[model samples]
Target: MLHQQVFKLALLSNALLLSIGILQNPSLVQATPSYKASNSGVPTQSARLNDTLIIPGLRFGPITRTTTYQDLVKMFGASRLSDHDVFGAEGLSRLPGTKVNLGETRSFLVAWTNNSRTEVAEVRTTGSAWKTQQGIGVGTTLTELQRILGEFEIPGFGWDYGDVVRPKQGRKFKYNIPILYLSIDLKAAKRYPSDYRAVQGETTILSSDAHLKHLGIKVGEVRVYFDQPGMTSAE
Candidate 1:
């Protein structure tokens, strides 16, 4: 019985010592910095290209020309602009699209015209990063574009913008309608692989593989513009 009493006293003494130690140094009971768990609850990265189609008479992804600068930052996350960065500048392109800076030397210019206080007029790009809902974008071969858009007219200047396509046939108000205008880099298309050269245009009749190689045959850009009679210009 004496030995059992001594064993009980030792167990109680250990519990009391532990409680006193915790009371004197409360931090010891607290979670350690390294042992503490956390969750950011947000994505650290995003897609490389916006991939949002520049739909005419509609919306460009989730934004438009009138999307305020603050909303733009909120939607696309705050831009990591540089000291020399030129945002919404005109020198970027011949059109009036405002450049929205996406960090790391990438951007898309949102332009407007017709003094239409509504949707964005045009979305232009010189890069091959972005794409449309139809999977058309820069680096798409003329043959691929033909397969996608179907029955488009070639521009007078050869592989360039100003190539217009009607949404429908025979309309008196067609002149005032909005048409799809493709902006292409003729020089880049001309340099595409031999297979891409097989695509034929209205003026260029491909008789042989060699002739096809010499034809300008790739889509380097795409634009949706409103036919504003004497207002639209090619770059």
Candidate 2:
């Protein structure tokens, strides 16, 4: 048992070393590897959030919950997806729901559990206005996001949409919540199959301290998605 643990530690250390090397080089993480980006916020495998996806400048204005492709064309002027297969992906779908301020909300997100290859995605099924904590214009609709992102997907556990809330300083809802994901499923040859489940009663953490007022949860609500990874990168 002791030898097994030592071997595991060694393997972990090697992985950490590899990741550090990749980060320091920066070139290895560049989108297109040898090409510059065509637009802003459209991250390739190389482009990563310097801070976090939840960074302050990343929020947009909120529109009605029922957004569509025409809204994206009007706002972005062109489409980046340029493909049909991406639309069929489960990672690209979000249920219809309005963005609201839950008022000092506290919640947690679980991406993977017990070595489960779970991931999260931000999908907008309709064209809606999204907002930030400061209530600035982020963008309108999912296609708008698609133009900015090109095409990509992340394996996730589930989402935390309804748990979001507005600030005490604002009277109306100021934040537009993008769909949150906890787990993701993938599709197979002619069919969608495969799933990743979250660790039951697993520990969780939050970036907000004032919202919790002092309590951090060791477990949280779990959601599931189906049909991811089963498809190749959009082409």
Candidate 3:
């Protein structure tokens, strides 16, 4: 009987010791798993969508008037951005710029104010992905533009500054102006000899011109310029 009592006391002591140890170190107990998500350093889908947005006179995705070449490298990585000479407006001369996405369908150009490339002068995209708030993008037809812009003018085709959309005087736009410029090119211009002849050259063609409606002219490029005072476009 005494041996049995001693054995019972030993068992109780062991249980008490275990309880004491657990009390002293509460971490000994299993804790509820906390599932914390970590970022893999890749941009999220929403972030990429924001980057593709073309906010006129303000931002092109993450790029702004103050965005630098180094900023481009950081945002898109050096592999996606490459040095290239982009043709200036009016085809005056080639200016230093960075080509984004290289040969991809999402390819775009960022022209700098100078060789320093410290400031963004313009952001041009032929890619259909970059679009304004009004859904006007590279592939938007001339008729669609007229419907949206409300009586805009188109420069004649077959020249350096040809096919550019110029807003008419006293015309009000749904959005702000002097920032977004669209270049409309008619790929089938050659097919319509009479229509092409009527609109080709350095003349200004009204958006409502009967010849232009059937020509199937579409916006080939979207250029966003930063040229206001205290802005980046100046030399």
Candidate with maximal TM-score: 3
Q: Candidate 3 lDDT, tens digit per residue, 108-184?
A: 89988899998888888878877665677788877787777778766577765556665554333444322333443
Alpha-carbon error at 177 in model 1, in Å?
A: 14
Winning candidate number (lDDT)? 3
Flag regions of model 1 displaced more than 4 Å: 1-51, 77-97, 103-106, 112-119, 158-213, 225-235
lDDT of 1 by residue, 78-164 (tens): 654212222222243333334667642245555544233233555545455555445555566656655654433432223322233
The whole-model lDDT of each prediction reads 0.39, 0.24, 0.61
| Candidate 2 lDDT, 1-235, residue by residue in tens | 4433543353344334434443454432232222233353233323221211221111112111122333323323333222121221235542322222212221111122112222222122221122222222222222332333232222222332212111111111112222322221123211321212221122232223222212221112112112111111111
**Candidate with the larger TM-score of 1 and 3:** 3
Cα displacement (angstroms), candidate 2, residue 188, comes to: 35
Scanning candidate 3 in windows of ten residues, the lowest lDDT window is 226-235
The RMSD (Cα, Å) of candidate 2 is: 21.1
Stretch of 10 with least lDDT, candidate 1? 168-177
TM-score for candidate 1, please give it.
0.44
C-alpha lDDT (0 to 100) for residue 147 of candidate 2:
34
For every model shown, the clashing-pair count is 2, 33, 1
